[model samples]
Target chain A: MKEIYLDNNATTKVDEAVFEEMRPYFCELYGNPSSMHFFGGQVQGKVSEARNRVAALLGASPEEIIFTACGTESDNAAIRSALEVFPERRHVITSRVEHPAVLTQCRNLTQKGYRVTEIGVDGAGRLDMEEYRKAIDDDTAIVSFMWANNETGVIFPVEEAAAIAKTKGALFHSDAVQAIGKIPINMDGSAIDMLSLSGHKLHAPKGIGVLYLRRGTPFRPFLVGGHQERSRRAGTENAAAIIALGKACELAGQHMEAENTIVKAQRDRLQDALMVAIPNARINGGGAERLPNTTSIAFEFVEGEAILLLLSELGICASSGSACTSGSLEPSHVLRAMGVPFTCAHGSIRFSLSRFTTDTEIDTVIREMPAIIARLRQMSPFGREFLKGQA
Target chain B: MWDYTPIVKDHFLNPRNVGDIPDADAVGEVGSLACGDALKLYLKLDDNKDKILDAKFQTFGCASAIASSSALTEMVKGKTMDEALAISNQDIADFLGGLPEEKMHCSVMGQEALEVAIFKYRGMDIPEHDSEHDHGHAYPDHEGTIVCKCFGITDTFLKKVIETNRLTTAEQVTHFTKAGGACGGCIPKIQELIAQVLGDADVQPRTRPEKLSNMKKMQLIQEVLERDVRPLLWADGGDLELIDIDGSRVQVAFRKACAGCASSGNTARMVEVKLRDLVAEDIVVEEVSA
Candidate 1:
């Protein structure tokens, strides 16, 4: 069976060009960029070049882009530093649909006696901008909003929300992990004081990320040991992964348009075919403007684990909300916030196409899915009743 | 990926007798939406009422849940109705190799479904044992919280099994009480019970070299049978004799049930697994062929 990968939202295959660019850094140019020696100075030179490459992609100055471990670390640093910058300002504003990286940090702060305002999202997983505006006040130290949702692919209006936070004299941090490569982003024009991006999500190796800290922003370092990352984040830099991420950003610039056009078309085609094949299936976060390459559908009656297992057997890779939260039995917090019904919640499957995804692969999934759904439904009491009602 | 046992992997990769039977003699269904697992079983009975002609199922749950149902269908099909009902949930799990701790509930569901299906066919009322309803079995001297809610095998149960069976340690009581096996959250309680039981024993200090063998499993089963089931049978003026064993199954002879009660089907069926697991693995025990 031809292996088909449709779970790009979870992670993408590393681009060959990016990997090749990173190879020399791993063995040959392996030196501490912090040291004053010639070998270390040469290492520092390559690090600066990687920083410039990432900065150019985000339309920011090289000095504004600080390398971190991953998007989660960047998010944590941004949120934690923002609060630390203004200790007396005890309030933080964020949407409930934000990734756990942001939501969890905010929750930890709340436990430490900081007031947190978790703004609710609309039924489509879009943030309630009015609620966000109401939540941000003079005492609110920071407003952390995600540029796009990881699970639902719903894009939030971060620019407008950042402007509101700016007016309130609060710092704005946008977790741009999902949006950095797939969509065009420029920190120069946006009011977002800080933004985070992960490498693995953009066809680069994992364990490397970029934090775009707007120039002239007041900041506090999260990791305060080494002088690396200009004392903003203290750790030995993952030079190879950082170089790979730089190459990935350069590739992203060249492929963003084609990815939006071709991958979006294929995603739409798959959604259309699936809708015709399976009854009572609806796209999650369908009402909002979403990332072009992602689609999450909830299949009524069948749980996600069974669906993924069957798909794995057929050499088709996809993801599900239920399996991600298997032992806990909680539905995806994003989907739950969107008011997705429980009947479909357990069965939600996410199919995310990438720049590498092909039309034939999408068609194969469209063809194989109806039969798989039918097979599972035949064995399910809920599914049997659903099919009977459809008849 | 988890290192699933070969049986679990086989059942997961290719579950047996899936899909609904067009017509079935009886059906058993359990599990709920809130629990995130459910199963529906279909049984086709032979006209002679001696064997299950066919069995199929529809299971909606996790990998282990589906695999358990598949394993059960594989074990019961073509077997006599009495033989099918005698199959335990543990046998279903063991056949699937083994399931994870949390996933033991899947095997439990399969076993419960089989018993309910038999009850449905026999026109007997299926006992709806409410897990929430507390039994009046008071904790005589134990203070720890109860675990292994399935068998209600508490610390007290462990103490009793140990004291009554000449069980010198926790390991022997675990075989009978079934504590610290499923879930294993009750292991500390089992250890405490062992300490309490051993401290009270009046036996002299004699170093008895334990007989260690490769087939410790077989030895444990034999000991359980000798100490537990043998006395109960003797009291009823009946006896059980071991015949032979191929693998986990053991053939046994029931002196009274072989020719007595019309409901001998219940004895030949219900107690067969308990007898088999208790007997030696090579000693297949069955009621003498009528």
Candidate 2:
């Protein structure tokens, strides 16, 4: 059965070009980049070339990028370094809708007597700039906000939020895991002191990530031992995945236009038709500036996990912010922080597209979504009541 | 991702009796939209009004929930009211080859709706339940001090679920009733309730008794075994009978499912640990033949 995978925000399929690019590095070009030998030197050059490719995608210099194991590590390394560099500061600020990688870390800091201020979001999942601005103080070590939420795809104005943190002499970081490939980013002349991104989110294989630390930002190593990543990160290089990420980054730069145009059109088409065909359905972050290839639709009086299971039966894969799917007794923290009503929050399904997403896939989802919602709604007590009123 | 049984998937994909009976003789609605699942069960009685002629449901929840509801309707179609009222949540899950532990509450919801339908049909006075929060605990028409504030679960409701499902751990309580699944502020309370249901009358639950004579320790160990340990094992279709008590070592013989069980060593160790925790610090449990 052909799988109609629409859960790109969770992780993307590894691009074939990227897979081929890293295939030879495993057994063929298998040499330690740090070893002082001719074979090692050849591998070292290729590693540097990969770094250059990754840097080119972010409009950054090669030296600014520190490779890590995954996006979570990059986020941890960036935040921990900021706090270590400014040990006197005892406050960390992050938005409430950040992925658990950053949110959990920030929350843990509170146990060590560091004050954490989680900036709230509006019902549309837009960050509250005023709360964020007021939260920044001279004691603030860093302000970390997500560039685009993984669940809702709502984009935050990190540049503006970063500028506010700088006024208080605090470092600013952005977890751009969802934004890097789907949208354009330029580190040059930007106020963001650090940014973290994941490889697998952009068609690269997992287990490779980058933390772009601007030049002149005070740095402390999160992992320390080997001189790998210029001693900023420790251990041996993930040469194969690192090389794959480099090629993926290059392809992402090449596909940015199509991502913003064709993929965006597909996302729009899906959401527009869903809103039209399914009554009482609305997008989660419809009013906000969102990622080009994402839409979260909440069908009232139905549960998201039920919709997803029905969708799954048809070879369609998606994700939900409902309480059941999250393994929690409540809906997603992102949805709750947005103050979304219980009616819609329980039924919210996120559909994220990619450059690889075909129009037929979107068409398939659009054609099947209304019926799925109708089926579930028909079985819902609230839905039956609504139908009775309609009758 | 739920590791659902094939039966569960089949029922979820092609749910049975997915509608309401317009002129039904009995109707029971449990759960709420805020709880992330709700079910309205309808039952049509035979002309004598004793046997269930038809059963239907309208459910809003995940796959397990819909499947559980569907299974409940199918299971009750031919049963009399007395037979239907005796149906347990575990029975619904059993009909579907069992549900994931985390989703046991879905089966519980199905069972609650059946009881509510029968109770309302008998004209039992069930107060209107608050649906603003996560759980509709009052659906069973029982009230008590709220225990799990996050899920809006009450002590009476939780204790009944704990007793009926034979829930051993606080985690199991959460899985079966969603009582302490959020914030976890009420886990200690849930544990206390579980101990209470298990007949653990010791003042300090799970604390080793202090200053007991060697003979007194033996009696206390037996009491703890009879009170707490045996019931927990029996809940799992297993049993152990006390064979002998030597100063610090206690001997027991397995019965039923506990007999010839490969993991009975772990079970014996669990009994030893429970005894040590509740009776005396040096208590030991050894399994022996009858």
Candidate 1 structure quality by residue, lDDT tens digits, A1-391: 7789998888999999999998988779888888889988887888888888899889999989889988998999998888889888999999898889999889888889999999998778888888877778899999998999888899999999989988989999999999888888887777999999999999999888888899999999888898888887888888888888888998998999988899889999999889988988988999899998999998877777778878888999998887322444346778778888766777889999899898889988998998887877776766776778878
lDDT, candidate 2, B229-257, per-residue tens: 86577567677889988888899999867
- lDDT of candidate 1 at residue A244, scale 0 to 100: 89
What is the alpha-carbon lDDT of model 2 when measured against the actual structure? Answer: 0.89
Residue A72 of model 2, lDDT score: 99
Top candidate (TM-score): 2
Error of 1 at B159 (Å): 17
Kindly list the per-residue Cα lDDT of model 2 for residues A1-391, writing each as its tens digit.
7999999999999999999999988889999989999988888888899999999999999999999999999999999999999999999999999999999999999999999999999989999998887789999999999999999999999999999988999999999999999999999999999999999999999899999999999999999988898899999998889889999999999999999999999999999989888889888989999999889888899998888988988999999999888678788999889888887789999998888889899889989988999888888888988878888
RMSD to native, candidate 1: 11.2
Q: Which ten residues in a row have the lowest lDDT in candidate 2 chain A?
A: A322-331
User: Which residue pairs clash in candidate 2?
Assistant: none
lDDT (CA) for every model shown?
Answer: 0.76, 0.89
